[model samples]
Target: MSETVRIDSWLWATRFFKTRSLAKAAIEGGKVQIDGSKAKPSKNVQPGQTIAITKGTEHFEVIVEGLSSKRGPASVAQTLYQETEQSRSRREQSSEQRKLARAAAAAPDHKPSKKERRDIQRFKRDNLE
Candidate 1:
């Protein structure tokens, strides 16, 4: 309904962040950018404007398609922004790479067994002066 909405509020409304405070924090921490430059939480967002959001290892580049101040359902929120094809592909690639990395860096399940622990201790003792 509004012609322009606050970036932080829009982010939460669009479900980009779980809370408005987190959106504000992200804006302040340089995780959200407008037109390739950092913007404040209170910055007004307009339709057709591009925004870059970074969450964890995924970076999203989206064009604001609508503006709203109230949080809405996921389906409705998704209409607020249009993610570019490149951004989508990049995100998918990043996700795949993360999966592969996780698989490669997999750790043993649970803690070491008592026998394994004793073996580790013995190995350490043998190596130490």
Candidate 2:
């Protein structure tokens, strides 16, 4: 409820990161940007400013709507920022691509059977010879 709040504190309060320390780490690692430029964890966040956050393969762009330094419930936290439509669509596309890639790269739950291994070895041996 202060006039200004630190970026990391706001991020944690908004539920972007599980802990303030993790938020600080991400900020230090250049994973969070404020108004299109890298920002420090201690940087102040004001309402109406835009922030870009990269968490793993997902990217979120949000405009600050409110500021709070204490963590709140999910519903309350979500109200802290407004996500742009473009950013939402991009995140959906990225998630779909990641799902497809993971499906394609999936291996069997169990190792290959002895017969299958033998066949593979035979094929390799024949090709090498």
Model 1 worst lDDT window (10 residues): 1-10
Per-residue lDDT tens digits of candidate 1, residues 1-129?
658999999999999999999999999999999998889988999998999999988899999999889998999999999999999999999899989999999898899999999999999999995
Return the TM-score for each candidate structure.
Answer: 0.87, 0.84
lDDT by residue (80-100, candidate 2, tens digit) is 999999999999998899899
lDDT of 1: 0.94
Clashing pairs in 2: none
**Candidate 1 residue runs with Cα over 4 Å from true position:** 106-111, 122-129
Name every residue pair that clashes in candidate 1: none
**C-alpha lDDT score of every prediction, in listed order:** 0.94, 0.96
Clashes (N, CA, C under 3 Å) per candidate: 0, 0
